[model samples]
Target: METTTATPWLTEEQQRIWRSFLGGTTVLMDRLDRDLRAAHGLSMPEYEILVRLSEAPGRSIRMAELADAVAHSRSRVTHTIARLERENIVVRGQCSEDGRGVSAVLTDHGFSVLEAAAHTHVQGVHDYLIENADAQDFIAMGRIMQNVVEQLHGKNF
Candidate 1:
């Protein structure tokens, strides 16, 4: 014999809000990706990787750290870096300190591309999200998201 506990479920309002959040985020991300692809020939994930590398010291970061910073898997980051490498946008080289670890370095071409893409990305973000939401609401949403991130970071899931 087994004992079972009752499951706790969301209230109607909570369920509705949760669904709205899921749908809204999906649409927002898709639009952003599409906009970036159309304007810069770069996918959102690749653009994110470039942004991370550009911000790092000497515009470079170790492969593993880049994946972690972008919240992507190592293989995924490697694949994207490979594509960038083909386009002369990025290059992978030995880390100077260890000479054993690999790092992704953004090229001059990549920086120029990123500079152009930033305008498109910023405008899209402003048009799609910032302009629509009240300033206070946006700030509150950021706080809520930060709390959510903290909670998730504490758990395995």
Candidate 2:
């Protein structure tokens, strides 16, 4: 004889937490994007790309690596890099190891731009998430998010 298991539904408390996470994340991201735009004339995605490039070795990374780092599609990364290139913030070069691979190098201007924008982004994060959250709760949230990321992304990455 075989037994069938029933699907479990979320409890009210679980549902509440899930909804709050969704809404809060949306609002937080929107606020951060708006703050970055108003302060530095950079969109959040562009800022993220610059940040990743700046942190990479030699202030450069392969376009595919950048897309993976930022969780964006290759096509989207290409478009954003093109926009940054036009602004003289970043330039693409043939990857030394593999000529077919493309690398995005952050220009001095790009580093300066990221430096100027970092403050606004940090403060927005603090204002929207950190300052408002309890210290213990925030740590717990971090752990929970790490678990989620590991469960969802660890295998693929």
Candidate 3:
């Protein structure tokens, strides 16, 4: 004989909020990606990777670190980097310090592309979310998402 535990479920309000979050995020991400693609020929993930490289010291970072920074899998980052390399946006080279690690370096062209794309991305973010959301609600949403990220990642993200 086995004992069974009852499954916990969300309350009606909780379920409604969760569904809203899911739908809203899906639409928001799609719009952002579409805008970037239309204006810059860049996908959201690629834009994120370029942003990470741009912020790193020397505009370069180890491939593993880049993947981690973007919260993407190593293989996914590798594939994206490959595409960027083909476009002459990024180049991969051995890390000078260790010589055993590979790093992705953003080319000057990549930076220029990013600069142009930033305007579109930022405006989309503002027009779709920030401008429409109440300031206090936006701040609270940020805090709530940060907490969720910390819980999931086991550290502040």
Task: Report the Cα RMSD per candidate.
Answer: 2.1, 1.7, 2.8
Give the clashing pairs for model 2.
none
lDDT of 1 at 39: 93
Candidate 3, overall lDDT?
Answer: 0.94
Which candidate do you rate higher for lDDT, 1 or 2? Answer: 2
User: By how many angstroms RMSD does model 1 differ from the true structure?
Assistant: 2.1
User: How well is each residue in 1-157 modelled by candidate 3, as lDDT tens digits?
Assistant: 9878789889999999999999999999999999999999999999999999999889999998998888888899999999999999999989888867899999999999999999999999999999989999999999999897778763435
lDDT of each: 0.92, 0.93, 0.94
- 17-128, model 2: which lDDT tens digit per residue? 8999899989989999999999988999999999999999999999999998888888999999999999999999889878789999999999999999999999888888
Highest lDDT model number: 3
How many residue-pair clashes does candidate 3 contain?
0
> Which should have the higher lDDT, number 1 or number 3?
3
Q: TM-scores of the models, in the given order? A: 0.92, 0.93, 0.92
- Order the candidates by TM-score, highest first — what do you get? 2, 3, 1
| Model 1, runs deviating above 4 Å | 1-5, 153-157
**Residue 137 error for model 1, in Å?**
1.2
Clashing pairs for model 1 are none
